[model samples]
Target: METLYDSIRDKTRVFERTGVASFSETENGVQVLTDNGKRVEGSILVGADGISSTIRLPAKYRALVGTSRNQFVENPKLPFLARGHMHNVYYEGISGFCVQGVQGLVFWCLFFKEEAWPDPRPASKFTDADCESVITKYGHLRLGTHYTFSDLWQSRVNASMTVMEEGMIEAPWNRGRVVLLGDSVHKLLPLLRRSVSQLPSREELAEAFARYEAKQRPRANICISMSNLAMRFETQDSWWLRLARRLVPSIPEGAWMPFFVEYITSAPRLDFLARESPVGRAHDLKSR
Candidate 1:
C-alpha cells in the first residue's frame, strides 16, 4: 500500500482530516466545500467514501480485522510462514481467513453474524477491550494445524472492528460533475476496482460516468452475488453446505487451475494504457 501511495504521490494532491460538506457544479468545473471551511476546485468529484458514503445501508455482519507483528521473526516456536498464501476455515456461523503478508506480517479477519443496524452509519470505533472480547470468544479456533486464532491475536500490532454492509445503491451514480465510486455504490465482501477521468462539459462528464457505471455495474453485481453465495456456504447451517465444506479439503490443487486461468483471461485492463502481452496458459487459451 505504501509503495502504491508513493507511486502516485508525486502526481496527486491529497487532502486528509477533512470531510465533504457540500458540492456544486460551476460553469467551468466543480466547487467543493470541506468541513474545515476550505474550498477546492476540480474538474470532477469522485466520492470514494466507502460503504458509509451518501446512501447508508444496514450491515448484516461485523468483522474484526488486524495486522500482527512479524510473527515468524518474533516467535521462533511458530511454524514457517509462507508469504501470499492464505489459511482459511469455515465453521458453522463463524468463518475467517489469515494470511502471512509481505515480511511475515500476519493479516486476518473474523466475521460474526450480527443484527442489522436500523440506520446506516459508520461503525462505532472499537477499543482494545472490544478486540480482547472477540479473541476470548473465538480464540480456540485453529487457522491450520500449527496455530490457533489466539496465537495471531496475541502478537497484534494494530486491530479494528467494522460492520460489513452488503448491498448496492440503485440510484443514479452521478449527477452533474460528481460521481460515486467504490463501496458508496456497491458494498460487497469481495474487492472490485473502477476508474474515471476529466471531460470538457457536464454532459460529457455525465456520459463518461454513465459509460463507467454501465461497464462496471455488471461486474459488481456478479461479485456481490458470489460474495453472498460464499457467505451462505460458510455461515449457514444447511446440509448441502456441510457436504460442500467437507468436500473442499479433498479437492486437488489442479482442480482449481481452470478457474485461475479464466480469472486471468477475464481481468479488466486499462484501455487508455499501452497494451502488454499476455503470458502462460491465459495467453495460450486466448490464442485459440
Candidate 2:
C-alpha cells in the first residue's frame, strides 16, 4: 500500500483532513464541495471510502482487528510461523484469522456474527475494554501451531474494533457522473479487490457502471455468502457442525480442487496489465 501511494502521490492531488460536504453534477463533470470549503472538479466521482462509507450499506458483523509485534521475529525459533500465509483459528461464536507477514508484523482479525444494521447504521467505536473482553475470552486459541491469540494481544502494537457491513446496496450504485465501489457498494467480511478502469462521457460512463455492477454483483454475493458460511462453520456450536469441524482437516485435497479452480479463474485481471500464461491442473480444468 505504501509503495502504491509513493508511486501515485506525484501524479495524484490528494486532499487530506477534508471530506465531501456535498456534490453536484456539472454540465461537463461532477463538482464536489469539501467540508473545508474547497471545490474539486472531475470527469466522474468514485467513492471508495470503506465501511464507514459516505455511500450506504447494511452491516451484519462486528470485527476486532489488530497488529502485533511478531513473536516469531522476536523468538526466531517459533515453528510454523510462515510469512504471507493466513492462519484461521476458531472458537464458538468467534472466528479469528492471523497472519505473520514478511514486514515483521502479525496482523489479526476476530469476526463474530451480530444483529444486522440498516443503511447508515450508527457510529460504533469499540473501547479498549471491549478489546480486553475479546482477549480474555478467546486469547487461548492457537494461531498456526505454536502462538496463541493471547501472545499476539499481549505484544500488541496497535488495535481497533469496527462493525463490518455485508451485502451490496439495493439502490443504483451510479447516479449521473458518480459511482461507488468497494465497501461503498458491496461489503464482504473477507478481503476482496474491486476496480474500475477507463474514462468515458456521461452516457458511456453510465453504461459502463451498469455493466460493471451487473457482472460484479453476483460474484460479490457469492463471496459474501462464502464468508458467512465460513463464519458459521467456525462459530456455531451445533453437534453436527462440531463433528464436521473435527472431520474437516481430514477431508481429501481433491475435494477442494474444483472450488480452488473456480476461485482462481474468477479473478479479473486488468486488460492493460501483462498477463501470465496459465499452468497446472487448474488451468487444465478451466480449459476443459
Candidate 3:
C-alpha cells in the first residue's frame, strides 16, 4: 500500500475515496454514495464489505462461516512459549495448540472450550499476556517439556479460541442486482488458508465463482469439520494422551492428492476429454 501510494501520489488521476453517502439507479447508469451527497455514477456496484457487511444489499445472501475468537495475555511464568514451535496440549475430549510466530509472537487454538462471538474480528487483536494465562489455565502445562513463557521473544499472552458456526445467516449466495463474493458466498474456516480474488473481467469472475461454489462448498465444509474432530481426538490429556502422541507421527497430513485429482478432473491426464487418453494411445500421439 505504501509503495503504491508513493508511486501514484503525483498522478492527479489517482485519488483516494472515503465516506460512502448514498447511491441511486438512473436510465444511463447508477450513482455512487459519497460524503456531502457527492456522486460518481457507474454501471455497477460491487459489495466487498466482508461477510457481515454494513451496506444495505438487494441480493443479500449468506454462507455458513466458522470463527475462532482469540485474545492475548502475558505469561511471565514461561516466556519461551512465544517462540516458533507447536505445543499441543490435550485434556479429555478437548484439544488445542500453542504455536509461535515472529519474535515474541504466539498464535493459538482451543477447539474444545467454547465461547460466543457472532461478530468476529481479525486475530491480531489478541495479546501475548492473554495467551499465557489461557495456556496455564486450560493446557496441561508440562513444566519443562518445551519452551515456556520465560523463553518468550518479548512477553507472554493468553489467547482464547472460541469457535462457532453462523447458523442464522445461511442462504444461497445470490438474489438479483446484488451478488456475493468472498465470505459473502462461502465463508471458509480458519486454515483453508487461501483467498479468491476478483477475476480479471466482471463476466468472467461471476461465471467462474458460480462454478467454484457448486464444486467446492461441500468439500470445504467437510475439511473444516474433520479438522475440528481431529483436534479433539489429538488433545486428550488423560493417560491416553501420551500414548496417542507417541504413536502418531509429528504433523500427519490428512490429504490425498490422487483422490482430489480424480474428484476435480475426469482422469489424471484429461486425455479422454481430448478425444483419446494417452494411457491407451501414447505411441499414436508421439508418432503424430
Candidate 4:
C-alpha cells in the first residue's frame, strides 16, 4: 500500500493548507496549487480522483472513455417500503431494485438496460413520490400500499450526477513510469467479495490487470450474459431457487479447504504455484 502523504510530512501539517483549485500539466509534470501559489512536481502522477476522474478525458482517453453513459440509478424516496425486495432482475431488459428500510425510510434501486438511460443528467431530479408512479406499473408487488410515506417525506431537491458506462479498449492502458491504478484502470465494478484483496503493486497491478482481461473476461462476461438471458427472480416467487439460496449454508469446509486434504494440510494450487516459482522451495520443506 502506498503511504499517506501526512506520515511523510513534518509534525506540523505539510500540505499547502489550501486545497488545489486547478490542475495543470507541463514538462515539469502535473501541477496543483499550494496555499502559497507554489507548484509541486510529481514524477508519476497517480489519478485516484475516483469514478469522475478528470485524468481520463476525450484526448488520451478518446477510445477509452470518450462518452457519457448511464449505468445505474436509485431514487431516495420510496413511498411504500418493501424490505429485501431487491431482485437483480436478470430476466427483463433492465435490472430491478427494491429495498425496505428498517425505520420509516424507503429506498429504491434499479438498473437500466444497456444504452437504456442517458447520462449527464442529475440522478436525484426525481423524488420518491414521483418514482412511485413510475415503478407501480412494473408488477404486482403491491408497492402502492406497502410504504410509510409521511416520515420519509422529509425531502429536498431530487437530482444526482448520472452515472455512465465506459467503453474498454482492446489494448487501452498505457505503461511506463506513469500509469493509472485501481478504479482508474478498471471501471468501477462492484467488488466480487469483501475478502478479496484489491491492492496490486504498480508492476503486478499492470500485468495482473491485462492477465485478468485476457483470461477472465470470457468467463466473467459469460456469467453476466447468462444472467442477462435469464429472468428477474423473486425469491418468494421462485420456490426452488429461493429455497436453495436461503438454505445455502456457507460452511467454509470444502471451499476453503480442498477435498481429501488434511485439516492442517497445504493447498494444491498454492503448492504448485509456489513450486514453479522461486518461492516453492520453502513450501516443499513445509509439506514434507
User: Any idea what lDDT model 3 has?
Assistant: 0.43
Candidate 2 deviant stretches above 4 angstroms: 1-12, 51-90, 95-130, 140-148, 155-165, 187-200, 237-251, 275-285
Q: How close is candidate 4 to the true structure, as a TM-score?
A: 0.36
lDDT of all predictions, in order shown? 0.70, 0.69, 0.43, 0.36
Q: In model 1, where do residues sit more than 4 Å from their true spots?
A: 1-14, 50-58, 62-89, 97-109, 116-127, 142-148, 155-166, 187-199, 237-243, 246-260, 271-285
Candidate 1 overall Cα lDDT vs. reference?
0.70
lDDT, candidate 3, at 210: 56
Candidate of highest lDDT: 1
Q: Mind sharing the TM-score for model 1?
A: 0.64
Write the number of the candidate with greater TM-score, choosing between 1 and 2.
Answer: 1
Q: Candidates' TM-scores? A: 0.64, 0.63, 0.42, 0.36
lDDT of 3 at 132: 45
Q: Give per-residue CA lDDT, model 3, range 1-288, as digits (tens).
A: 355367775565343555557766555445676785656665444443443343212221111111111222253444435345567655454554555565555654454433433333433333444454455554453313654322332232432332233221246443322344444433442111123543234454446555645555665555546544444455452466556666666544555444444444431233333554334543344333
| 108-145: candidate 2 lDDT, tens digit per residue | 88776554432334335457877787677667777667
Model 1 pairs whose backbones collide:
none
Per-residue error for 231 in candidate 3, Å, reads 6.3
lDDT of 2 at 2: 49
**Candidate 4 — what's its lDDT?**
0.36
TM-score of 2: 0.63
lDDT of 1 by residue, 1-288 (tens): 254457775544666567889989889899999999989998888776643344433556667898875464466556435767788888876788888776858788887765544343556545677678778988889877877778778777788887654677778888888888776777622222333533468888787788878887777776676666666665644678868888878999899777766655665644555657654554467455
